[model samples]
Target: MAPMSLQDLVASLPTGETWGPAASEEKTLNGVPYAPFSKGDKLGRMADWTAEGRDKERGGRQQYTRNYRDQIYGAGTQTGFEIQQTEENTFSLVDNTRTTKTRGFGRGGGTVFRGRGQRGAQTQRGGRGTFQRVGGRGGQQGYDSRGGRGGGRGGRRFGWKDYDKPQRNRDASVVAKPDWKLLEEIDFARLMKLNLETSEGEDIDNYGFLYYYDRTFDKQPGAPTSQRKLNIIERAAYNVTTSDDPVIQELAEKDEATIFATDNILSMLMCAPRSVYSWDLVINRQGNKIYIDKRDGSNLDMVTVNENAAEAPMETTESTKDAINSPQALMMEATRINYMFPNQTVVESETSKREMQNPHPFYNPAEESDPPASKSYKYRRFDLSLEKDDEPLHLIVRTELDAVVKNNINGDDQYLTIKALNEFDNKAQGSGGALDWRTKLASQRGAVVATEMKNNSCKLARWTVQSILANADLMKLGFVSRTNPKSPDSHVILGVLGYKPREFAAQMNLNLANGWGIVRTIADICLQKPEGKYVLVKDPNKPVLRLYEVPQSTFEEDGEDMSVARTGDDDDE
Candidate 1:
């Protein structure tokens, strides 16, 4: 066959043929079925893929006869060389023999192999910069430049261990023995004799006052029981007069003591003022008018309690006579006591419009004092009772103390000072004001309330019975209602008030203990309910406190299933 040159091969190929052999159905130039390019294709139409076919023949097949030796030797040249595997190619053998001779070396010099073996080639690990060498066949060894082994030279594989272990907590269960026995262990009779008093001459103990009453009043022959009741009433008045607790101070300032209990139980009650007074009520019967005094200024006829009672006796209305005679009627007068000063109240409608734009009068306390505790501490008692029970179970009677000493004092200023001290939890710095001065303002307010209570004590006492029976909780707490044969619904609980503790003991009535029990039951329900810890409902905007004393049974029944739900076997895990 003639030698085919590159030009001859190109000229003999089909024009339309692709780089690879055409599809199985494609036609060849000389009647062959499989061709490198399609029949009708033009030259230079092949893509980069066609360039790869240059290494093969026109038919998309390699020249099998053209081996490396044949190509190197070419057609006529003959080179005698046989391809054979050498000993190095057959296997990698372990050589135990090692050379020990040195060739002009100092630090690089060594005593040769420690063991008789050829060391494997040292391989440098990428990025680690550390080298490791295989000993003979399987033996391997490496060392860190910093005299450490393993992970990467001197580096360590750091990790958190036992991070999931539970933490230890301090035990808070240590009971210490007291140096002296508790007060409960001592006979209350002997302890009552201690009669401790502060250096300032104020009684430091509640029992001290009781002790004084017992020694001086009770021991006296034919002393009226009224004398003992007077002492308790005085102590309560004292608390209103001097207590830092706002509730007590408010009662003193307002001259009122709220009776929070019913006739059935007279041992305990949360008492305070019926309403805080912003202005003093001064009735000018001579002028036939009632005047409201803001202390700084006064207004005439703020209310028409009586139109012409002062002008003519026959002109006085029945309502006017009733209002003049009652303390509750006086309390009702408090409703119109405006916080606005005399100047603000006098502002004309046109002037008020301009003032409203500025609003300085409203915001400035000096110009406008806060309305006398608008929702009276009296309102709080009702709210508390209503929240816990469907209706008020007891009467918050407005009462006055008997023969209380009146000392001139500013109730508001004193209350403010007391409040500041309480906020910082501080005691009075020096001698407190004289008891006379301390109690004077409260006494005046208290007297008004007391006079009202005194006139209506009989009627109020009856109302108290109805109130006690109405309260289911008070009834459950052993406050029994006795029915009267004459009045269908009316009843009486004897000795609810005015009975002395000594009288109870001497008569063996045990009434004092029963009274004490009622108090304890109330305290427990208020403080120890399991549903949550005890907390006072406080609204800073409202100065009054709403308090309730729930019965123990009531609180437990509220969460009756709690104890049962908490029961089960302990889990060691």
Candidate 2:
């Protein structure tokens, strides 16, 4: 065949062709089923994939006679190479030969629980909780490219290894897991409370029990216990002056937990703030009105709760109470808190959005502004940077912290800066804020999300959940799975992206290469077996090879089976 133009070559192109070398640079051609061109992914030359380059045509229809001896067919011919490396540089990844070392989750060697070890030291009993560990290696600052926050062995961080391009090797992908609280994994009741109560049911006003004589909590709430879990509440904020009656003032300042538990009305008067909230009932100081802040140029409201109420933790809410009395209000606030908790009852609340954490969007700070922490320890948080995908997809990456390193100078200031999210569990005790933040993150299609500056860097870890969960295809293809209950599996979240993968994910395992799959060893790929065995779904052109890596199971220990199916044990040879 004569030398063909790019257009002619693409025109003659067979289906399932991987356009490349210069294809990504071409942007778009007349009409071709071309893969989304990414300069990062390796793409070989288009011409080399043709029958003109090799003998026997590589297994009938299989492309890429990737063999080097066929660089030129016969003599006096031009070199046909798919991958072009200019005089500049090229990157390649080399894997560790020790395949036996790769085990799933806890049983895997050389893998360490990077955040958990740090938490044990900070706590009273010297630490037994793995989820509570904070910070990464290299001082308390894990973000620094240097030492202290990474590498259990104290060398450079070890990640996907590379050959040739040293710069690309240094470009390590740090996959941080979500900081899953030890609380209820699925929150089945809460899920029912929101969906059935709000989405499918009538707007049942004032359904939850109103406490007139309940008591507030005293000890810290770490995990979910029948008696220990915090309750979400709707309350009224009040302002009492020098001329006011003692009865109202006492009730206004009292803690919800104290009033509900002990019913000691005089000692602890729990005021009812007609605000939509969860966890703590925010008591806005009397005379406080709706006001706007310059941030984001959006109308914002602060509780302006009495400095005395600062003794009790208060959260902020973004739910608006306007026109709840009107039918249009129902349509306007469909997906947000309005679905369940609507209307901040106070009439003035219509002017501004109520400020308190509840159901979906909630935030309970480690320490209140002017008040000391209710407990002895200071607040800790994490900061991270995520690679922005073109679209939101379900994604989950779990890396056990090698060990946690912590330093608490005083009760007011504590530092636990580390890798991943679970470590931030103890300090960031607001599951409400986490759920809200996750929703916000999922809204951003493709954005590199990072937490604000704080000692601990990986608080909530909800963004990680959003990343993997939204990308249903990737998650179903065995790319991500939850390491904890808060992350049970991608099933529910993937449903958000309109995907169901219960069957496919269950069928294949990376441990067995008999079926069609992708890069088995980061090396060879088998498109189709000669005898016509199994094929990969949605990827008819590409072969799916089995991977031999099986994660270690906590199932037997948890009284649950591996659930991961065993491959038929087909031999590659």
Per-model TM-score on C-alpha atoms: 0.16, 0.16
The number of clashing residue pairs in each candidate reads 14, 74
Cα RMSD (Å) between model 1 and the true structure?
38.4
Off by over 4 Å in 1: 1-237, 241-266, 270-501, 504-510, 529-573
lDDT per residue, candidate 2, 216-299, as tens digits? Answer: 111111211211211122332122221132332332354211111111110011111111111111111122110000111001
lDDT of each: 0.22, 0.20
Weakest lDDT window of 10 consecutive positions for candidate 2? 564-573
Report the C-alpha lDDT of model 1 over 1-573, residue by residue, as the tens digit: 989998898889999665776467666667776657564443332234433453463223342223222332233222233223367766553422222344322222232222212212212101011112112222232222222332432222111121252322211111112221211111112211222111111111111000100112213222223121110010111112112234333433453322222211221111101111111111111111111111111111122111111111111135544422122232223112211111111112332121111122112345444421111011112112224444332212211111111123532210000000000001111111111211221335334223323222222222222222222111000001113222212221111122222332333212223322332333334323333211121111121222222222321233442232211101100
Judged by lDDT, which candidate is best? Answer: 1
